[model samples]
Target chain A: MPPTEDPDAISKTPPEPPAPLAFDRPAFHQQAAPEFACALCGAGLTGQYYQANGAPVCSDCRWKAEHESGPPQAGRVGRFGKAALYGLGAAAAGTLVYFLVLWGTGYEIGLIAILVGWMVGKAVFSGSGGVGGRAYQLLAMGLTYVSICASYAPMVVQGLREAQAAETTAGAGAPEGADAAQGSSSVTRSGSTESFVRMAPNGEPDSQPLTQEEMQAALPLPDDPEQMQPGQTYKVDLASSEEELSPALSLVVFTVVVAVIALAAPFLGGLENIFGLFIIAFGLFEAWKHAARPAILFEGPFSAGAAEATRAPALPEAAEAHGE
Target chain B: MASSADVRSPAPGASHCPACGCESPAARLLCPRCGALLHRRRLEELAAQATQAEAADRWGEAAGLWREALALLPPGSQQHQDVGRRAAEAARKAPASLLDQPPGGAGKMPKILGSLGAVGVALWKLKFVAVFLLTKAKFLLLGLSKGGTLLTMLLSFGVYWAAFGWWFAAGLVISIYIHEMGHVAALRRLGVKASAPMFVPGLGAVIRLREAPADSLEDAEVGLAGPIWGLGAAAACWAVFLATGSGAWGAIAKLGAWINLFNLLPFWQLDGARGFRALDRQQRWLAAAFVVCAFVLSGEGMLLLIAAVGAWNAWRSDATTPNWRILATYLGLIAALSWLAVRVVPMPT
Candidate 1:
């Protein structure tokens, strides 16, 4: 009645332009789906798919990937060894720097203890390729403690030298025969003027001056004794001329004693000053913390909807509506 | 004019691709050019599922289904436009649904314990002590950075140094730095981008977030992180004071605690306001009660302002769902900070 419409003619006619959209075109339509199959297992994804790296993954594969995979534990021993070596190197460097600061400033900067800990921890972390663990933490803490303690070595040695000089000056005018005999006996008994001074108030000394050979034997002889001049008379004043007799050997012995003291200095210092101990503890805690494996907790399985909500309004109309 | 059916359906033996407008044989399930699903039946199925999900208040699922349906419809079509709008609306509601869910293991605690009140809450959170400390330590270590943070810190230190002397200025500036880093750490942990701490002398430091937090819980966590770290720094100073018997450390500890406690006042954009956003009416009252108790016990004048603001918040009708972990953290922080603030008198330095 409207003149029977020719279906072929109707199909040949161009379609009318589509109506304007009330909303922007969906972003998902721009990219073609990579596959209908799961990326991980190659199984067909019919329903309830998750995305990993923007590719579809089946639930079973996603679960397996999340639960089964973790950081590898292999080569852990080698990592620890490397960490230990690095920590030791850091400790040596830290100790030298700390000593220099102390020497230059003449102040015990407590903050330096924290710096030492940080350095050792960072070194250990780097050496292990950032694979940190309990072993690494222990190594870092140990190295840091040693470094802090060892920095006191120079100070301890200097203190000992000054004391030794004071004792030598105090005993310089004593009668040579009596003092020599007392000093030799005391040096033989305790190998130090410190103990000799303690016993000096009570001990009676022999009046006779000892022969050079007897004096040498009684005293703790240096490895290389100075040769006597042909006509020179030797005075057996052990305290005063002790340095002249064996300066190199005395220094070596003093260093060994100071090393032992330096090793104990941290604990001894801590005992005397609790603040120092706490500060040291803080530093050690920093090292221990930084060297331990960081715990990372993953929270998700979130819907892509949330992401879409936060996505930028890229469409010009949408952007204008949002005043972006 | 074309009938609705004619507009929706293609000619016999052929169909049009919604995505790319390509014509294809009806037998083919996908568009030849764009690979978009050409089956109108599939779009109907997705729309049906989305309706069911919406009815069930599963906004996330509904949003996902609507999105799928949107892809199948021809662009600019009424169905496509409607579904797109629906998807966006559902996405907006998804975060509210998330907020309704209990966070982590706190949901598993006996309801009786919750009914037992704040003491029970504190006791319940005792198990989280290790997690709390570990989290703080992790964030503290992660927040360390050079360059901008260091330069700004030095600038702030110089400003403070002129006023408070080097020792107090150093301690104060460090306390503020730790506080600001707490925000940076929390933001980073939540995967929100933020700038490093930038100091502004007397105004304290700030880290600007590049994006808004997804929900109130996220907002509160970021807000409270600063005070938590500030508390830690204060506690450390207090411990140092105890060990060294230095008046300077004592002063630092006292001032640090005071500053952190002051940040707990529930006003404007301060951390306490952010934290209060996560609390329900009852929880807000409880927090207010704790603030009052802290003020009475500690005799800190600053707590009065906090308590007043807290009381005002409690009185308001706008309230959120109760988050016990946040409540517990807030209460614990108030108690610990109040104790530190009062107990450690700033000795004459």
Candidate 2:
């Protein structure tokens, strides 16, 4: 049987009671005995008594109640651990959403990075049960940065794949031309260096000008694909584009470079446009503002005795009954 | 009837009856004959509960409790006077029902409707929009008569002339004046006293409110009105650009959109911060989602800041009941302005 159809269950689940009024409880109707006593400490009330939460309390007891409770407990490490977990989850979700939008639309909207920051900040705040401090704020900011960097991973990978495909196509179509282009460029570079060295000494006191034969020898040799040796490896020049690395090594190097670029994307993207940079700063400020510790002001220990002094003067019989 | 003396005093260890001279035993706290309180415990309890309610921001409840406490205290006593003052303060802080209830019948549209029913509702909404625009136009016209407004407008136009050409400067000044006039219009509608619009050379225009808004919702409406009018000015420029094929007008339109969108960033004394004050957690999230959608569609980077701020606001502990009308107006402004801002066009050489 469905729980909804059960009469007993329905009866057991009582309706929500309305919020209670201040004096909703039945009125107290017992008179104080001739012997005066403090409600909290059971001590005799002779001169003065204080009221706390409506009961007559002795001075010592009232003081203890007001001062004994210390400041609110600090947020424990376990709470921060929970906050970290939630922040990571939110970061992952934000990255996925950002990537999907970029891939689907073919436009990189930098605004989504702001949304990622907002999500991570909110998640951390919630996971810590709304306990916000310097640590939680730092955690939120770090997670937000990671989310934004992670979002660029897919785009970077796709770009690398496209570039590699284009290179492979070019490498397959004209192997001899490619090799000759490389060889001629290197030869021309070396010929220029040698000429510079020979020209430097021509005006020197002990050196004579070069002959036509020497000049002819200085000119770069014409490239011939047949002159290239099989399976010969060329030293990779860091500055020249003609030098190539092995496929595996190149892949590793490209991955590292792409990772750096991805990590710096948020900052780099902002630097391109002033408005983008301002908006990114505003987004980060929002996350920081949301994760700051909340300030609560508490009003002071008001004097109840002052009001007591202004009460209507008691009659002789009332004074005697109240022991005032 | 018992005399005043009898009401004030009774035999020792006996409860005094305020209505009659009957004396109950010492153990009895209430008058057996009249049921009047014989002890101050009940009054104290009410006072304590009232304090608790005030701390929780349940002002209405606190007011009620304070009133009850006031009734139990002896007249002309300091405690009675204090409770009475507290009750008044609590009543003042209580949320007004005016904001809780949606204005007009627009919010009462039937959820399920036929084709004709839908058309009827749309027509009704259109009528409301027309009336709103006409009212704002009336206020704008009235604002032009102010001597201070015209003098300051000329001053701002002159200041801008050196940076931008005369024609562009004039357009910019007019756009800002219209934006300031929007606040004047909303203030007049709400019956709030305010000064005429005054333009600052570099800092845009402003109007001094002689009276504060009655509630957060009213404050939000007044705050958002400026941007709403600014959006209209931008759209008008865009239309001119489309008609005349003028790069200058397109630039003006884009700048107008950008300025209004910037004002929507929810922080400090900006318009957007005031607008978000009335929204609860759910409504704030809804506004954030709307901003995200607008950003996606238009690819405007400014909306991201608004979205981020909206999300932050959603996590805040303090919130009032949601106002759908404010939400609709806020989201609509963001979407229209974002779309206008992204309409790329050449700047006139």
Candidate 3:
């Protein structure tokens, strides 16, 4: 049998948008919500299943709470994990930039790269950290950033420099006026032993002589051409013996060593950098922990959390849906 | 009648109200925590975030947060209206102005172009990974980025280089932190809620704010906050430079002056940008033009003139800025002072 609709029932029915529950009341009927409060901090739950009831509470609480649960846990050395990650990232970025400078604008400028590193550090971290003051922390970070760049950049720069020098040596030869078209010195090697090679400004035999030992060290005896480091000065002496011979560079690998030295300095000043890194990790960790710990505003706090935790397993059949 | 009702009712949502523990008969609830009418959790969601203000140094994030927080407030409430007004004020203010920018704004165009370039990079990375896996799975080296920057085995060069890095890094860290602390000082004076500066990996520190200020007072103070530290640091650095009789002092002084000057720019990310936006718009455009031109022209005049035109487009953007024009104007005066100081620094050999 078709049941006739009750006109009064339909008409009397309201057409309001469904009301959201007043947060003052409890969420579930009677039986306390399953683990509605955080077990560790006793912070009340929000949403479904175990989240702080609108307050931030989590491992940070855990960090604070670590005092009670036994001996304070010392953090692991992290196998230098965080440092390695950040350092690598910085190095790669620096290297790319160094290469870009060379490739793009031929900006072989060094300090600008250093400045850029500081700028990058400023952009990334906004200059905070360290024991003494904000500037010190910025210095540390800037150094870290610049050093990272120093670490990766020289390799490419060194490689390019070596490549360019190699090309010059390879193209050293042309006859007569062609070689002297510009004031360039042309070097010729001796047979077998590469003993007593000569370098004349325009291919004259009367030239500077490099001792056999110096020749072996700077030049690969009979095969490899001599390589020069950047920022090095080598003087080819015409009558130079092994004892007297001095190359354009007094020392090999000067720029590379200097950069490495700069990068390594931050580690020695203090252990503050490590602590600063921990802060970074902790901050990031807090951001992650936010999902679990809802930002709950404090209003005495106990009535909300304590009730949910302690009042569970009690019976209130008539008052099933209501709670403070 | 109002008194009796109030006495029995115990003001709703009042943090001190005893009746707050009881069930509410009304459909709308009041927040015992904040003494606010509990419309929905979403409204206060921004303040709920710990890092929104913490990472305010992030230009994009800081602006986004202020805007988002403004949107969340109920439009008509006093506080809501306040936020709306401030946000509207910020909007009315010019961020960094492009008017003074050198004609073509070489720097900004490069930056914009550079930002667009990241897309190509992402695509290339995807292609590289795909091809690597498809061609030779064994050759694919994932997690290589986690490896060291060749730190373990010190090359003869690396050992010396590390020492150099140690000194400079220490000095720079000190300078950077000191600069940031000045910001903290200003913020604390203004009674803004801010966390101690957190260290960023391979970067600098940032203080977090809990919420946007209802008025521009706090914002202006906060905006002005950072430069004081920078100036102090520069002064100190220069002092050291002088005491040591090192030529580097000139460079350091110049840098400090420049940092102060550049920060005064009326842009969103830079401190100057914040200051300029805090004031009214008329000054914002003027200050922006001044900054862009001064910076570009001072550093690379020819390039700046060309870049100024490009910067004009960024200046022309009428989007809402959080700061006002007064900050920019004041900052300009400071910049002029610093510029004079920097100009006096002897050129390095």
User: Against the true structure, whose TM-score is highest?
Assistant: 2
Q: Summarize candidate 2's per-residue lDDT along B65-156 as a digit string, tens digits.
A: 77666556544433444566676667667765332223464565455533568687787677667866665566577777999999988877
Better of 1 and 3 by TM-score: 3
- How well does each candidate reproduce the native contacts, as fnat? 0.01, 0.01, 0.00
Clashing pairs in 1: A275-B243
Which candidate, 1 or 2, would have the higher DockQ against the true structure?
2
How is the predicted docking of candidate 3 categorized under the CAPRI scheme?
Answer: incorrect
The regions of model 3 sitting more than 4 angstroms off are A1-167, A170-324, B1-36, B39-78, B83-167, B239-244, B258-270, B300-325, B328-330, B333-349
Ranking by lDDT: 1, 2, 3
TM agreement with the true structure for every prediction:
0.35, 0.41, 0.36
> By TM-score, highest first, what's the ranking?
2, 3, 1
CA deviation > 4 Å runs, candidate 2: A1-77, A96-115, A151-256, A269-271, A304-324, B1-181, B188-224, B239-244, B251-349
Candidate 3, residue A64: the lDDT equals 41
User: Candidate 1, residue B31: CA error in Å?
Assistant: 29
- Candidate 3: tens digits of C-alpha lDDT, residues A1-324: 999999999999988632222222223332332333355466654322211233223344433432333211242223123333443455356556556545543434233334344433432332111011223233335444554445344555566579767665654433223223223322333111122233344434223333434333443222323443322223343333345424645335656565665555435455444533333333333222221211222221223321222232233531343322
Ten-residue stretch with the least lDDT total in model 2 chain A: A304-313
- After best superposition, candidate 1 residue B69: deviation in angstroms? 18
* DockQ result, candidate 3: 0.01
